[model samples]
Target: MLRTVSYHPVVRALAAHGLHTTVDVSRTYPQRRFTDERDRQYAIAAVRALFGDPAGREENGRFHCLHYESRPESR
Candidate 1:
């Protein structure tokens, strides 16, 4: 069985800083109310293609997932 994973708020906070969010992976890592299977898969593939290793996990009442980091100077 899959164990529940913790959601690191810092991860979401950082993703937000760059206009990105963990929600981007709904397809590959489906959870209640977050997204449907199709979207999740699309998101997963999209992320993998872009970031090489996209994060996908669950915690609390929500699902946490991978996010890309912005360049130092971009922020």
Candidate 2:
């Protein structure tokens, strides 16, 4: 568990809201579509990348989960 007490403004803001844990979207329990789906998808992809999920792939040269690669313009 890497906890570096990030100094980045975004991290600080999220920390203020207790959004510290990685937003997991796994093969066993995929994140569901929500009203704020784009945000969730992006967060899930980021969490996958952070945790080194095997299904994470490169899309337009940027790294994200497989679903984001398939549905590139969801946002």
Candidate 3:
């Protein structure tokens, strides 16, 4: 079980201040260890809420990754 604070909105606020922001989220355990699909979805949603859409996603045998970057021009 993972819990995230509502500070996700701060990412945009930092970008508004002309600061570049990057976030990387990776699973701590193997995919098979996460037996609950809802947990996977929740993790994805939490990261998305904090950083907006992911710039990239990758999954290998070991773990999954979600990458996010906020560029001033993109915003």
Candidate 4:
């Protein structure tokens, strides 16, 4: 059996400490498992909510990637 884990809470904690994060989504997982595009989009939305906005994004084959950098210190 395959189990799924969520890292959203950990990502949020990192963001709160001004750490950088990168998220990568793909249509397939190890062992030939697959995921829907809608699910990937939902993940993107969730990450964006925590990290604000991605500093970079890329699409490689069936993979969608996002990079989030620590925000600059406010004046």
By lDDT, the best candidate is 3
Tell me the TM-score of model 4.
0.31
TM-scores for all candidates: the values are 0.29, 0.24, 0.30, 0.31
lDDT preference between candidates 3 and 4, better one: 3
- Candidate 2, TM-score vs. the true structure? 0.24
How many backbone clashes can be found in candidate 3? 0
Give one digit per residue, the lDDT tens place, for model 4 in 1-75: 111234557668877887656554432232321267665455446446655332233111122323334453455
| Clash counts for the predictions, in order | 7, 0, 0, 0
Could you give candidate 2's per-residue lDDT for residues 1-75 as a string of tens digits?
111112246545656665553433343232333346465456546545555442433212232322211112223
Ranking of all candidate structures by their lDDT, best first: 3, 4, 1, 2
The digit string of per-residue lDDT tens for model 3 on 23-64 reads 655532223333466655665566466554323331121224
**Higher-ranked by TM-score: 2 or 3:** 3
**Poorest 10 consecutive residues by lDDT, candidate 1:** 56-65
The lDDT of each candidate is 0.42, 0.37, 0.47, 0.42
Decreasing TM-score order of the candidates: 4, 3, 1, 2
- List residue ranges in candidate 1 displaced over 4 A: 1-33, 57-75
Model 3: which residue pairs collide?
A: none
Between the candidate structures 1 and 2, which one is better when assessed by TM-score?
1
